[model samples]
Target: MNSPGVKIHHLDGIKILDLFAGPGGLDVAAHFLGFKSIGIEWDRNACETRYAAGLPTIHADVSVMRESRFAEIPSTVDVLAGGPPCQSFSVAGNGKGRRALETVKKFIHRLVDGEDEARIDEDLRALDDPRTALVLEPLRWLLKAIDTEGRDPYKVIVLEQVPAALPLWEVYAKLLRGGEGRLKGVKYEAECWQLKTEQFGVPQTRTRAVLVARRPGHGAIAPLKATHFPFDLHRGKRNVAQAEMFPAEPATPGGKQRWLSMAEALESASSLENSPVDVSRLRRNGRMEFFVVSNYGSGGDPKNRGQRLSSEPAFTVTGKVSRNKVYKSMAEYEADTSERFTIHESGVLQTFPHNFPWSGNDQAQQVGNAVPPRLGMHVLSWALRGSPPSDDELVAAATWPNTPRTTTAELRDIGCGDQSQCPPGSHKVTRSRRKPAP
Candidate 1:
């Protein structure tokens, strides 16, 4: 039987309020599908980048401007989307997730225990920075909006972060939907899951924890499927149902889905391997390395050596440039990628528009921090009432710096201050006291 061909639909004028929108990656997807969105951002450079990209933005921190600031938008809004900054919770950065988790847990406990909301407010007000806790701002807005409207305030809420934030997101789902049994006063139904970007047609192996909540009568939140199946990455398009029948790998998606490998994406740069290689002189901040010298810097552990194979999706793009080093293996000449990925290449991997007119002072940071418009498209497409976009539409949204579910409170805290519990091969390596230049 032939799978019904996908017919892309117009966005139907759904509006979105994007929080912590960095460089407009999510907004890019919204635009591709013809949706209106207003992004809230505090970073001046990132705001400049968003404006140059033609995305509307409010230049203010979520804490400062607040969601109420945008409640007056002329258009009716249906979705709220954003991925809070991950530095405070990322293993690559100083591990403040533990401290922030405690405070947030206490705050949630108090709120559910019938404590005065004002007193809890005063306690959180005294918090020191509480950067990791910034992720909670979205939930705060969700509650405020639903109560203020006395109905489903928004059709959907989408949030993404590093794996560490999974627990916090689960906690949020519990508080909002009352977890197992829908509480008497809960506002919506919610679910969370972990999604690998490569499976979703992104040419990268970045994994994120995503949570989706919707008011009753809307679809339930479930793990978004990969448009580009893994087996498809190895071969051309095939029947997706067949793949589903023969579960090859442990977590393989059943379908004709094939991943878009790095080679396919960087075909433009295929001939550039002969150019001069820019190898790092010192080794530090990397979680792994190749068999070269100990000083040769890279990001993963000994097994992967941080080499991003052209045959596979790229490693997770990070603010740290040293994480994903390109490894070119030619018939005669094999070495680390000679030149660094151009700003455009990085944008492509992040699934941004080709050479998106970058206006920010920190080009790398802007690119790395985005959610990839392609990835955002899949999310926004499904988020709309009835999940209207066709499968083809969802797949089209995943070409580059593109960008999913719910897991339990499986986040580790004991060794979280270090990378001890990060994914295999992503722990920090202490080298000579000297630091390396980016």
Candidate 2:
């Protein structure tokens, strides 16, 4: 699996720079994999959470990080990673970016042609959501590494975003592969895939579009293999092809686990004594099962609210996660709202450590925007090691830091910054990337 000039080093020697890092989800995974990591995030709320988790961070905007020839960037960066703001392209938001796909592609080609920054910025400002143009920032950084006189090109690149961004990722894969336009003979092996969170053992049912690329001479790479079945597949509701492709039970010979459930994740053992939540109240009709009643509508109909069972993964956690109600059964839901998931419980569903300190004003947004750390571990292992982490490693990463829980109030007391000072578009977070049902 070794490649010329791209040999895998001891994990300790690898270094990574994460742009738009939202509360260190990938940074936490990089730590578990023994890679040194530093994240640059403009969001103060996320920065506070990172500090509480003991992750290194550079509190600055990604747009500003490219100044002075990337002067503040570490010289030994081996991996380039980021998740740009996705609201413009998300179905949950207005489809400004999606509508402007052709325009974004033109900008990408302009980057390849060495267009000046001012011209590009001026054109980008014309868009409905300028944040949509931020998706190209990773490519800007990547291209700079190759063009700058003294810098060595990054060996690997990984990016994640809402599924609607997959078309954009496909465009990136082409540019990295190299051909007629500007990246002639680059020969990097690159691929993009839409992956479900639950398939990687996350307790939430969400999907993300991911792109992984290796420099020239690195061996070809493929999408990360799923270690668990999806919610529908585990319930035997999927078609024959998917069923045959993945094992049915955790006990099956292939060793694939069934989809992780909300109850299992929230109730799992953790290093912090206060972390293991007592979900007995969620038991339906005295049975050991629970349900989640979403605050949002199903298919845009307010009367048709969405719901999921405890045996299955929870619905995609949103910035409004605290608004969702958990009930013992349909009867309880119809009678009245039972209880809401606490901030800590909400983080648990996202596969964040139980004790992770949630900080700043909008704590719910902080947790919702994070890349699921468990899923991060799998993806990072695939990019750097060309394989998946062992079951033992995954288990160990889940309990990362092994520290006591840091309360949200405590984080605020320590200068997390005034909520009013954060600008309107400063925060960057992804929304649901799953496909719309027929």
Best by TM-score: 2
Candidate 1 ranges beyond 4 A from true positions: 1-14, 67-75, 109-118, 125-129, 147-152, 179-186, 229-254, 268-305, 322-337, 385-438
Candidate 2: where is the Cα deviation over 4 Å? 1-14, 179-186, 233-253, 269-272, 284-288, 297-302, 402-438
Candidate lDDT values, in order: 0.60, 0.76
TM per prediction: 0.68, 0.83
lDDT (10s digit) by residue, model 1, range 1-438 = 111221011112438888898888888888777687877777767766665655656566676545335443323666888898887777766677655777777665565555665676677767655676577678666655544643456667888888888888888777767622222375668777777777666767677888888777865666666666543233243333222343334354445345765555555332233312122321123311121111123343554354334445666776544334443333112544433566666777777755466775788888889896777777777666445356565544433231200000011111111433223343334587757777
lDDT of 2 by residue, 1-438 (tens): 222222222222438999899888898888888788877787877887776776656667787767542755667787999889888988777889999988898899898877787898888899988889899999888777776779877888999999999988999998888733444345478999999999999988899999999876657897688988766634355333232454446675656677777767876733346665556566565654766778654665646777677666788888889878777766777788688888878888988877776766789988888888888888989999988977778777656464333422332322223333233555546687999899
